[model samples]
Target: MILSRLSIINFKNIAQADLSFSPNINCFLGNNGMGKTNLLDAIYYLSFCKSYSHIADSQIIRHDEDFFMLQGYYDNNGNEEEVYCGMKKRQKKQFKRNKKEYGRLSDHIGFIPLVMVSPSDSDLILGGSDERRRFLDLVISQFDKNYLDTLIRYNKALAQRNALLKQEIKDAALYEIWEEQMSVTGEEIFKQRKSFLSTFIPVFQEFYTYISGGNESVGLSYRSHHEHGELFAQLAEVRERDRILGYTTRGSHKDELEMTLGEYPMKRIGSQGQNKTFLIALKLAQFDFLNRNGFTSPILLLDDIFDKLDSQRMERIISLVSEERFGQIFITDTNREYLDEIIRKTGHDFHLYQVIQGNIESLKEEK
Candidate 1:
């Protein structure tokens, strides 16, 4: 899948712009707060129907603007596809495919599979368990459409159970109903997550090895209550305890993906560069996984990811994506030197743009 064109209006700092892209690479150059990252986020919104950093939809609209719009033209295999999104303050956002509105936004997710690696990815290690689980869900949601529906069902059940707990309901039968639902849906999610990680871990490790030259070994392990023998039984056992805490304590929502460097927790031991390397490798592996599983290679988005890396690591990343398997890429950077070196190393057709404030102009393109 290739995003051949993108049109935006009142999105973050971008006032209005329509631009084309190179099938190979499209690079954006700008300083901090110059709207480079927002441009990438616009493309990300087109794919995932949300922003990479997870801000409120209203906040994404340009200041003093009541509404925003984004449209993308894509080439999927031999078929042409058009995606459109429009939002207004205090109103529902409309998403359409080929100009026909979608009844459910979830249906549009995997249709344009994409993998984004941004500086915010550091949250995976530095942040809490929720961050890692989100990474898991985002990757799986792209390849498995029904996974999101299952997750939604599980969350609803968990919420109901929690609400009952908070209300101090004396009804054991009500508790049984939601607990049973949670067990069923949560177990399915657990199985799929486990299955995805079984194949994902090795690919992640391989990418890390190549990027870091195997100087240090990294590892990821899944932690879940499901392995404790039946989510239903565990939830029943924790029922009384959950009532005391006013929340359901045992479910997939509490599962975690632990990150490690050389057998120790990455959060405590990893230096800045090491942590960044870990995230970049992880995202590249995500791209690889979606490429192998999806109908076409997924688009790659890199948001200010070249900030802290050394020259060798950057070159390895450039070389890896330059290969044929990875498709269209959108990259944002503050340094011209890094983008220039990428152009030289990849030797692929590309478009380079300069972003100033909220405006974007095509500075150059190699046809």
Candidate 2:
């Protein structure tokens, strides 16, 4: 799917914008905080129905504005599609396809499969285990309906179990209720996660090698209590202990994706450059994983990620992203040097714009 045109109003710093795009590469140039990322976020909002920065919808509306709107015109396999989103102060955001509102946001997950690489991704390596689990869940949920549905059920069960623990409910039967749901759904979630990693890790390694020129090594190991015992049995065993802690302690909620650099923890051994490279490769591999699945050529967003890398890796990334398989890329950069290189390398249709204080104007275009 390709976003041929995007219309925005009162979203983030972008007061309003209606811009056409090159199906190949659409580049935005601006200094920090001039709304380049916000423009990309508008596109991201249409894709995921939420901000990538994880802020409240109320925060998204422009100051002094009571409502915000976003609409995207897409070309999918020669068919045209329209996606619209609107939010009013103190009201739920509405997302629609072809002018019809969605019954559930989950139904929109895979429709416009997208992968974004930004500086915030550093949290995947530096933040807690929950960050890594979120990475896993986001990728898998985009491609597998069963996995997404099972994850929703498992989280619901976990929340009920935790509430019971908080209340100090000692009835094993009461605990057994939610545990039954968690055991059935949790086991399915863990299996899907394990299966995803089994296929995902190798592709990630291949991307890391290509990006780093094979100068460094990386690994991702999945750790789950599911491997230790059946989820129900594990929950029963940990029940008494969890009662003391006041939260459910044994389930897929405790899962982790340990990232390693050359057999050592990435957080301990990775320098700033290596960390950025690792994350970029990880996300590109995610794009590859999604594109190969049912989603055809998922949109790719690169947001000011060229900093702190040597020329070799930068050129390698430029060469890699210019390949034919990747499609409909949106790139944001603080300067033109790297964007110029990418435009030169790809030799495809492109439109470049300058963003200033929520205003966007076309600087150049070629087709």
Candidate 3:
């Protein structure tokens, strides 16, 4: 799918803009805080129904603005798809396709598959287990709607079980109700997660090898309690412990994706460049996985990720994306030289835009 055009109003710092995009590559150039990333976020919203940076919809509206609106025109397998999203202060956000609003926002996911690589992705390496679990969820959810729905049900059951544990007078019957539900749903999620990683790890490793020139070895290990025993038994065994902690202590929610550099934790051993390279490779692998599974070619978004990388690694990434396997890329960077190099190397259809304080102008076009 290609986001061929975008319309934005009062979203973050972008006051208003109407822009067209190339199907192959589109580049946005500007300094930090110039709304370059915000432009990309607007595109992301059309796909995911939420901001990539901000958790709250109201927070992303322009200061003092009543609301924000975003719309995208997509070419999905040669069929035109119009996606519309709008939000008002203190009201539920609206997301629609072809002028009809979605009854449930999750329904919109995977319609326009997208993979984003940004500086914030370093969190996958340095942040908590939740971050890693989210990475798995995001990629898997894009291709498998059943997995996403099961995850939602699992989380809901987990939440209810935790609430029961927190109650002063917990009923064993009620606890079992949620625990049973959690166990069933959690098991499905665990199987899906494990099954996904089995196929995903090699792809991830391949990209890492290509990016790092096979100079360093990396590893990804998925750890979960499901491997030990059934989730129902685990939850029952930990009932006392969970009550004491005021939360469920054992489940798929605690699953971790351990990143390693030569058998050691990357967090403690890898340098800045290594860490960045690891994240870029992971995202690209996700793109490849999604494309191969069912999404044809997921849209790729690169947000200010060129920093802290050696020239060779940077060139390798540019070369990789320039290939025909990738499709409909959107990139944001402060350096024109990098964008220029990409254009010179790919020789594919591209459009460059300059962003200044939420304003945008077409810089060049080679179609």
> How much lDDT does each candidate structure score?
0.92, 0.93, 0.91
Q: Mind giving the per-residue lDDT tens digits that candidate 3 earns over 311-338?
A: 9999999999888889889999999999
For 1-367, candidate 2 gives per-residue lDDT tens digits of 8999999999988888999999999999999999999988898888889999999999999999999999999999999999999999999999999999999998998889899998899999999998899999999998898888899988998899999999998999999999999999988988999999999999999999988999888999999999998989889998999999999888898899999999899999999989999999899999999999864789999999899999999989999999988899999999899999999999998999999999999999898
Clashes of each: 0, 0, 0
What is the TM-score (0 to 1) of candidate 1?
A: 0.98
| lDDT of predicted model 1 | 0.92
Model 2 misplaced regions, further than 4 Å: none
In the range 1-367, model 1's lDDT, one tens digit per residue, is 9998899999999999999999998999988899998999999999889998899999999999999999999998978999999999999999999899999998988999999888889999999999999999999999898899999899999889999999999688999999999999999999999999999999999999999988999999999999989988998898999999999888999999999999799999999888999999999989989989988889999888877878788888878877877778888888888788778877889999999998998889886
Give the 10-residue window scoring lowest on summed lDDT in candidate 2. Answer: 291-300
Better of 1 and 2 by lDDT: 2
- Shift in Å, residue 68, candidate 3: 0.3
Q: What is the lDDT of residue 60 in candidate 1?
A: 94
